[model samples]
Target: MILWFTVVQVVVAVVAGVLGIVLGLAGRRPSDLSVGGLALLELLLIAQIVIAIIAPLAGNPPTGSLLEYWVYLVSAALIPPAAVVWALLERSRWSTVIMGVGALAVAVMVWRMQVIWTVQVA
Candidate 1:
């Protein structure tokens, strides 16, 4: 995985998470800005997925289990959309909170992916 790209992804996720939490605390539902942020995060994740697949073909395979890495990548890809859908359905401040939680989840998953990529074999 590319280090800078991963860093950007983490930053975006954290920002989105914080934004969501602030909005929720302000007793607002998911706004266009929040939804757009989530959409942007989703785009970044999709880019990461493409890069992950291409990197190995380009001879840059991850050091950890490929299956595990792929699983994380796939799950990370799903989060934003799922959160958005849930938020829309719920139509409350809690929807923003849910989005925040989802954003945090993506951050952690990305961090785990970084660890997986950098793991050293004995």
Candidate 2:
């Protein structure tokens, strides 16, 4: 995991999460802002996926369990779409909150991925 990229992902995830939460608490239902924010996060995760693939070939392989890192990466990549689907189907403020929670969950997962890639031992 690239440190800078991880930082950017974390920042984006936090922003998306907070934005959705605030909008939901303000009684807003699913909107472009919330959905778009999640979409953006998803895009970033896709990029992270590519990076993860290339980084290892570039001789920057993770220090920890490669399988564990890959699992976390893959799981983190799935959260946004799931949350967006939930929000779209429900079309309620609470659904937006669920999106926020999902984004936050992705943030935590991404952080864990980083730790797995660089901090933990196999």
Candidate 3:
């Protein structure tokens, strides 16, 4: 994966996570700030998907197990929507925290995906 793009995703995810946790702890329910943050993060993941598709064709193909990289990428892309749905249904501070945790989880998963793409060998 592209290093700069991965860094952007990680940073966005971290910011989103921190925002959600801070808002939740401050007794805020799921609001635009929290939900919007995740939405933005998801958008970044989608961009990453597009990038991944094109990067290989551009002569930057991953050196790792393609199956593993794909699995991590796809799974990371799913987390935000799941967390948002959970927050909407539960409508509690804890749900907000869950979203935060989910964002953090995505961040970790994205990092792993990067490692798989750039470092791992098949």
The number of the candidate with the highest TM-score is: 2
Candidate 1 residue-wise lDDT, 1-122, digit = tens = 99899899999999999999899989999999888889999999999988987998998878888888889989999999999999999989999988988998999999889888777441
Candidate 3 Cα errors over 4 Å, as ranges: none
| Candidate 1 minimal-lDDT segment of 10 residues | 113-122
Each candidate: what lDDT? 0.91, 0.92, 0.91
lDDT of 1 at 85: 99
The predictions' CA RMSDs to the true structure, in order, are: 1.1, 0.7, 0.8
Report the C-alpha displacement of residue 59, candidate 2, in angstroms.
0.6
Cα TM-score of candidate 1: 0.96
How close is every model to the real structure, measured as TM-score?
Answer: 0.96, 0.97, 0.96
- How do the candidates rank by lDDT, highest first? 2, 3, 1
What does candidate 3's lDDT look like per residue over 1-122, in tens digits? 88988999999999999888988998889988899989999999999999989999999989898898889889999999999999999999988888999999999999998998899888
Query: How many clashes in each candidate?
Result: 0, 0, 0
Arranged by TM-score with the best first, the candidates are 2, 3, 1
Q: Which lDDT tens digits does candidate 2 get at residues 1-122? A: 89999999999999999999999999999999999999999999999999999999998889899888888888889889999999999999999999999999999999999998889777
